[model samples]
Target chain A: MFFDEFKSWQKELTHYSFEQVSQGDVERALGHERLDFMDFLALLSPAAKLYLEPMAQKAHRLTLQNFGKSILLFTPLYLANFCSNQCVYCSYNIKNKILRRKLSLAEVEVEGKAIAEKGLQHLLLLTGESRQASSPEYIADCTRILRPYFASLGIEVYPLETQEYRELYAAGIDTLTIYQEVYDEDIYASVHLAGPKRIHRYRLEAPERACEAGFSGVTIGALLGLGEWRKEAFFTGLHASYLQKTYPDVEIVVSAPRMRPHAGSYKPQYPITDAELVQILLAYRLFMPRGGITLSTRESAPMRDALLPLGITKLSAGSLTSVGGYAESTETGSAQFEVSDERSVEEVVAMLRSKGYQPVFCDWVNLRDRRGA
Target chain B: MQQVNCELLNDPFEIGGQKLRSRLFTGTGKFSSHELVPQIIEASGTQVVTMALRRLDWRNPQENILNYIPKGITLLPNTSGARTAEEAIRIARLAKAAGCGNWIKIEVIQDQRYLLPDNPETLIAAEQLVKEGFVVLPYMSPDLGTARRLESVGAAAVMPLGAPIGSNRGLQTRELIRILIEEISLPIIVDAGIGRPSEAAEALEMGAAAVLVNTAIATADQPLEMAHAFRLAVEAGRSAYLAGLGARRDQAEASSPLTGFLREE
Candidate 1:
C-alpha cells in the first residue's frame, strides 16, 4: 500500500496560531507609543504598502534611537564550490559544468588574512554542499584556525546534525545562516532533486538544531522568486517569530534574497520586483523591529544605499561570490552570481563614509573570546 | 560645632536575590578614555554602572567593557536607545546573553532630540521583562502617576527623571518629586537631570531612596572632588530629612501661634 500522508498544506497552515493582523493594525502600531508583535504583522500587510514612506521614517527614527549614528559592515568570502545536489537554480550545481573548486586550508587562511588586512572584522564563510570536501570537521577546523584572525566568524553552508553544530560551537563558530531556499516543501523538494539537500525537512530543521547546539544566532529566509512570494514572506516572518520566541537569546536576522542573474542555465519563473523586495523588507522590519535585517551584495548600489538606514542593519561590502575570489578573483573562472555592486572595499567604505555611515570593517564580537574553554 | 560621624554607603541594599549597596549608577558613554573610566567610576563610589549595547568592536583589545570595570561593581546594562517595547526586549535579551546582569534599565525614548521617555513604551517593556523574570528599573519622566503605575507592575524601582536625560539641568520638578515621595512606597531613585551636589542633596531631601548622577560627576573638571562633594551632599540631605526639617510658613506669624494659644501668663 502506498504511504498516505496525514498532514497537508491546509493542516499546517491552519495549525499556525499566528496572531493575524491587518493594515489598520500596522498603522495603529506605528502611531501608538509601543509596537507589539501583532502590530508587526499589520505593518507588513498589503494595505501597509501605501504607508511605506511613513514606515521608513519610523524605522529610521527607531534605528537611530537604538543603534545611533552607526552602520555595521561585513563581507562574505565564498570558500568553496563543490556540490552533490542538483539545485536547478544555483550556479554551483553539480550538473553545471562550470569550474568547481574548494579552498584548501592554506587558501582559506590566505583569503581570511587578505580580508582581515582590509580592516574587516566580521567574516562570513560560504560554500556549496560537499560532504566529503566541506565536511563539518573541515569547517570546524577552518573555524578554529580562523578564530584568532577575525572578530566575528559565521557560516553559510550545508545543514549538519545538532551534534555537528555543537562540535562547531566548540570550534568557535559564532553564527550560522542556513537559507531554506523556499519554505514550501513541495517547491523545495522539486528544486532540490538529489543529495542530502533533497530532504526538505532536514534543511528546515537545521537552524533549530543549530540553536539547540548553543549557537548565538540563527538567520532564516526564503529565496524570493522560488515559491509564492506572499506565502514565503508570511512563513519567513512566522519562522523568525518562532525562533525568536523559542530562542530569545539567539539573535534573529531575516535576509530577503531574490534570484539574481547567475551562471546557471535555469532562470526564475517568478521574478520579484525591487519595489516588492523593499516592501518585503519593510514588512519584516515592521514585524520584528528588534530583529537584525541584512542587505547583501545581490542588490544594486542604489537599492542598497536607499535601504541601509531604513531598516537594514547589516551589509556585506566587497563580497566575493566565488571560491578563492579574495586572493585571486580571476582564478575562480566565473562567479556564482554577478555582483550588482562592483565597488571595491575601499570605494565602498568611502561611499559609506560620504553617506554619513560609519562603515565598520571588523566584527565586534570575538567568538574565540566568547568560548570559555 | 560637632564632628560628624559620617558613614560610608552600604552595598547590596537587598532587592530580589541581590544587594546593591552603592546607589550611584554610571554609564560608559560620553567618556574620553576607557582607562580613565574605571578610575572615575571607582572614585565616584558607584557600585553599579550602566552601559548600552553596541556591536562588538572585534579589533579592539578590550571590545567588551563589562570585563574592564572593577569586578565587584554590578553592571546594570540599559536599553537606553530602544524607542519601542520590542527593541527594548531585544536589547534586554542581548544584555542577558552578554552577562551584563539581569537588572535592566528599560529606557524607551522615541524623541532623539529631546530624549524624552515614552511612558507607554516603557510600561510595555517593563511588563514583558518583569513577566520574563527580569529586575526592571525603568527610566521614566518624573510623573507621579506613572511612577505609581510602574511600581504596581513589579518594577524593582521607579527611576523618575529629575529632567531630560543628560540635560544636567538639575531637578526641575521638585514639587512633583515631593508628590512621588508621598505616593509610591518602592525605591524611588531620582535618575538623570541632576547636575550638582545641591541637586543631589535636594533629591535626597525630597525622600528619594537613592539618586543616580552620572554626567554631573563624570564630566566634571574634577570628577573625584565632585564625587566626594555629592557624597557629602547626599548624606547632608538624608540627615536633614531624617532629623525633621522646619515647617515653612506661608504667612508671617508671631513667635508662637497667635490664634490657637493665649499669651504666656
Candidate 2:
C-alpha cells in the first residue's frame, strides 16, 4: 500500500523547505530532460516563482500535447448530507445542527434525469461519511438507477472495504474519488474529531483498495488549508505518483480543493494563495504530464477559466452540493460547501467552446454495454 | 530528371497493408523548428514520418506540428514518455481519435536513466492495441523471444533500438537486431541511435526492412543535406542487399588470374 511508502516519503521530505529549492534545480526541471521525484521537489520550491512564465508555458504545452483541446465535464449529484463524523472544516459534520436529507431511489432518478437533461454523461455521486445513511449497497443501487443516463459513474463518499468496492464496480461505478483531507497526523486527528473518517490509515488506503477492487480510475485529494498548504500539495502529488506507479492500469487523478466558506465557522489555518495553487498545478503537470487533473467549482469562474489551459483535464460543471439540489433545492443548509462558480451546464460548455476547448462529456466507453454477451 | 530505379521499385516495402516506397522512416523530434520537418521530408523522400502524439496541437494553429507535414506521407504517431502499457495504449487511442490514423508506434519506457523500452509492457500494449484494430509497431530492446511474441500478437513491425535513445551511437545492439530479423517473420525496423548515414545503411544491408532516424538528421549542421545523404545511403544499402554480395572467406580468394605471369606459384 502507498501508506507505507508515504511514511518514508514524509521522512524524506521533512528537512526540505519550499525556500530551500534553488534556481539551478528549477532550471534543470524546466529543461527538455525527463523529471524525477527530486526534480519535482524543485519545481514545487518557492524559487520556481521566479520562473513562473516558463513553467506556465511548459505546463500549457504539455497539456495541449497530451489532452488536446478536450475538457471532460462532470457534475456531482449529492445524494445525502447525513454524517457521523465531526470534521471541523465541513458543513456536513454530525455535530452541526442542520436538516440532513438522503435521497431515495425515486429522488435519485429525478436528479439523474435532471443532470441528463443538461447533456452531462458523467456523474459523480457524493454523500457525507455516514454508512448508516449512505451504505455501499445504497450507492450501488443509485448507480444502477443512474447508469442508463450517464456514460460514466463515480462515487465520492465514505471509503469501503475491497469487497464493497468490487460490488460498486459490478454496479457500473468505474471511478472512485476519496479525499484524505489532510496528510499531517496531528492536524488530521485535530480536525476529524469522531467517526470512521478519523481513521487516517483507512482513508489513505482507500484509493489503492478501490484499484485492487478493479475500479478503472481513482481520484485522491488532500483538502487544502487543513494542513500546511505546501506540504499538503507535495504529499498529494506524491500520492498520485505512487498510485500511478503501483497500479499501472488504473488511471489516477489529483485535485487541489482549496478551503471554501461552508456552513461552519471554522477558519483555515493556512490559506494557499492563487499563485501558490498555480505552482502546485504546474508541478503536478510537469511531474506527471499524462495524469488527469480535476478542477472543481470550489474555485470562482474567472480563476477556473484561467487555470484550464494550465493543465486541468476534468471540470465539474453545474454541480449541486446540497442533497437533491438538482431536482429541488430545498435543503439549503445541507450543502457541504459553497461553490463559487454558479454557472449552468450550458453556460460552462459555451465558455469552453468560446476558448476553443472541446467539452468531452464521456471519453470512456463500457465495452460490456457495447457488446452485450 | 533523375534516373528511375525500376529494380528497387520491383519489390515494394509494405507494412500493415500500406505499401511504402522508401525504407527510411524519420522522426519529428530533436529539430530546432517545426517548419524544418517538411523540408527534411522533401529531401529524404521518406514515405513514413513519425511524430510524438503529445506534440500534436489541434486547437492552436501556431503550435500545430501536423500543419507543417505535407500530405501523402503516412503519420506514425509514437507514444513517447509513456511509462507503462496502459499509458501507451491511451496515447495510441487518443492519436487515432484525433485523426492521426491507425498507425501507432508503441514506446513504453520505464527505465528513466537509459530510456529503454520495457519489452514486457511493450508486448502487452502491442497485443492489446492490435486487438483494437491498430497497426501497432512496438519499439523495444532486441530480443528474439520478444520479437517473436510481438509478431505473434500481430504487430505490424518490430522496432529494436541500436543503442540508447539520442545517444548518437550506431548499431550497438547490431547482433541482437540481426538475430531478431533472422528469426521473426515480421518487418524489423531499426529505431533510435543511428547517428550517421552509414549506420542506417548498415542496418538495411543486414536485411532490416526499415530504419527510423531522428537525432542524426534533425540535429545535423545541415539537416536537409543530412536527410538527403541518409536517403541515398538507404537506397544504396537496399540495392546492395537485393543484388547480393560475394561470400566471406578465411583465406585470400583470387578475383584475378592466378597465372605464373602474375604470381610465383
Candidate 3:
C-alpha cells in the first residue's frame, strides 16, 4: 500500500532541483515545531549544510527533552552468516567464497549467557537471508531459547509474511528491524543482483507487516553509502514517518548506517563523509523528535562518541558480526561485515559514562508469557 | 504587601498505605538537571514523586535514579509508553522488580498529537495492575463514566487531566472534573495541564484530593522557587476549601449599613 505512496513521492523528489533548497528553507524548517517531508528534504540539501551547528543544537536539546540523558545499549548477536542473496556490498553474498555457519540452539544459549554476564539485557539477533539455514522457524527457536536470559529480543533477518511475523512474536520476540539497504529501487536492484532481497516492494512493506503482526517496536534504516545520501535519507525519513503514523502503538526507530568493508570488494558509488552523516542524523532528529534514532558499531569510536550527544538514542556496544563469535572468543566463521568500533561492552559503557550518558540495557519486559502470573 | 495571616494548613492524606503530608506531587521529567529534583521536593514539601520506567544502565548498575530521591519520598513509576493493558502490566512488574516498590502511575497514551490519555486502555491497565498487587493511579481524560469504571476496577486513585498532557492549558475540562470530584468516591488527583500555581490552587479549591505538577515547575527559570510557590498555593487553596467558601448571590451585598452613612445624613 505504501509502495505506491513512496513511488509518487520518489518521482516528485527526483524532479526538485537540489539547488533550490536554499538557506531560507533550512531556516524555516528549523523554526517549525513539527517538520514535514519537504522540510526533511530541505534539511538534507547541500544549502542547509551551513546551518549544521544550529541543527545539531536543536537536535541535542530535543533529544534531551524527549529521552533524557540516557542511551539504550544493545548488542547484536550474529546468529548466522549463511545467505542466498548476491548483494554487492555485503561479505555474506552467496557468490562470494566464504565460510558459512549457523549456530545451533546450544550455541545460541552459550552466546546469550556470555552477553548476559556482561549485564546486558537487550539483544538484536542478526542473520544473513537464507531460508535453509536461517529460516523463520529457526529464528523463532533462537528467540525461545534466549527469551529467559534477555529482557528484550529483536531480530534483523529476512523479510517474511505477516503470519510468520506473528509466529515470531508468539515465540518471545519483541522487535523486528528490517533495513531496505537502499531506498532507490534502481540502485537496490543493481546491488542485490540475485535473491529474495531483490524484491524491493516486499522489503519495503516488511515493517508494516511486522506491525500488522503486533510487534511492539520496528526499526528501519538505509545504508548511506550505496545511493545518493540525500535521496536515501529523504526516503528513509518518509518511510519511518509513514510507519510511525500507521502504527501509533509501535516504536519506530530509524538508523543511518554507513557502508563498511566486507568480503565483496565493492566501493561506494556515492560515499558519505563524516560531516554529511552528521547532517543526516541531525535531520532525522529534527524531523522526528520523539522517534528513536540509532547508531551502530559500523562507525568509528570517535565518530560514534561525537554523534552520541547530537541525536543518537540507541547504540550497539562490543558487537561482533560473525556467528558464534561471542562464545568462542576467536573468529569462528565469516563476518557479515567488518566492525569498526571493536571496544568491549565494558569499554563502551565506560565511554558512555565519561560522556555523561547513562547506558540503558533492559527497557522492556515480556508480559505475554507472564499473562496470568 | 499585606499579610493575610492565614492559618497553617496541615491536613494529612493517605494513598496506597503511605501517609503524605504534602498534597502536591512532582515528576522527574523536563528538569534541566536531575540534581534539582531533591531540592524541589524539599522546597515543595512533596512526599510523592514519579519517574518513568526505562532500561537500566549496564555499565553503572550502582548509579540508580532512586539514589537522587530522598529516603521518605514515595517513588511513583509511571507506565508512560504503554499503549495496552498487557504492556502496562509488564512495565509495572519490571518496575517493582527494579526496587521501585508497588506504586505505578498507569499512563496508557497512544495519541502522539495531543498526548491525551486513552481512557479505555487505561481502565484496562488499572484493573490488571490492581489485580497484580500494584498501587495503581491511572491517568485518564476527565470523564465521569471512566472515572467510575476505574474506581470499580480497584484503582487506588483516579487522576483526571485538567487538559491534554504537557499542554499547560489549565483546566480546560473544568466542568467535567467538577462532576468527577462530586461523584467519584476515590481521590481525584488532577494530573496534567495545570501550568500555573494559581491553577493548582484552583483545582484544590474545586475539591481535588491532590495535584501533580511537572512541566510548570520543571520548565520554569527557577524550579525551586516555583516549587515553593506551588506549595504555598496548594496550602492556601486547601485551607480555603476546608474553611468553606461563602455562598454566591445574584446581586451585590454591602458589608456596611446602606442607610446609616454620615455623608448621606
DockQ of each: 0.01, 0.01, 0.01
> Ten residues in a row with the worst lDDT in model 1 chain B?
B256-265
lDDT string, candidate 2, A161-262, tens digits = 999998888888999999999999899999999998989999999999999999999998889889987778788888998888667689999999999998
Worst 10 residues of 3 chain A by lDDT: A364-373
Mind giving the per-residue lDDT tens digits that candidate 1 earns over A1-373?
A: 0001213432555654333545555556666433444455456566666666666666666677766656677888776788888988888888888878877788778888888888888888878888887888888767866787788888999999989989888888878998889877788888888888998778877888989999888877998899877667877787787677557678989999988888676777678876667667867776676788888889888778777767777888888787776775335634678789877888878878887888766535753554324
Cα lDDT of model 2 by residue, B1-265, tens digit: 9886677657678899998889999998889999899999999989898988655355674667889999999999999989999999999999999899999999999999999999999999999999999999999999977887898889999999999999999999999998787557689999999999999989998889999999999889999999999999998888876654333321232243211121221
- Give the interface RMSD of each candidate: 29.9, 31.7, 29.6
Q: Is model 1 an incorrect, acceptable, medium or high docking prediction?
A: incorrect
Tens digits of per-residue lDDT for model 3, B1-265? 9654444455777788877778999998998876888898999989999999777688877555677899978999999998887898899999999889899999988998889899999988888888889998999999888887898889889999998888889999999898788667788999999999999999998889999999999999899999999999998788876755543321232333211211221
Model 1, position A346, has a per-residue lDDT of: 88
Candidate 3, DockQ score (0 to 1): 0.01
Cα lDDT of model 3 by residue, A1-373, tens digit: 6788799998797689567898877877877666667678889999988877777778888899999999999999988889889999999999999988888888898899998888888899989899888899899889888988888899999999999999999998889999999999889999999988999999999999999999999999999899989989888998988887667689999999999998878999999877788889999999999999999999889778888888899999989888877876434778888899999999999999997999998788877772211
> Where does model 2 exceed 4 Å of error?
A329-333, A369-373, B1-265
Which number leads on TM-score?
2
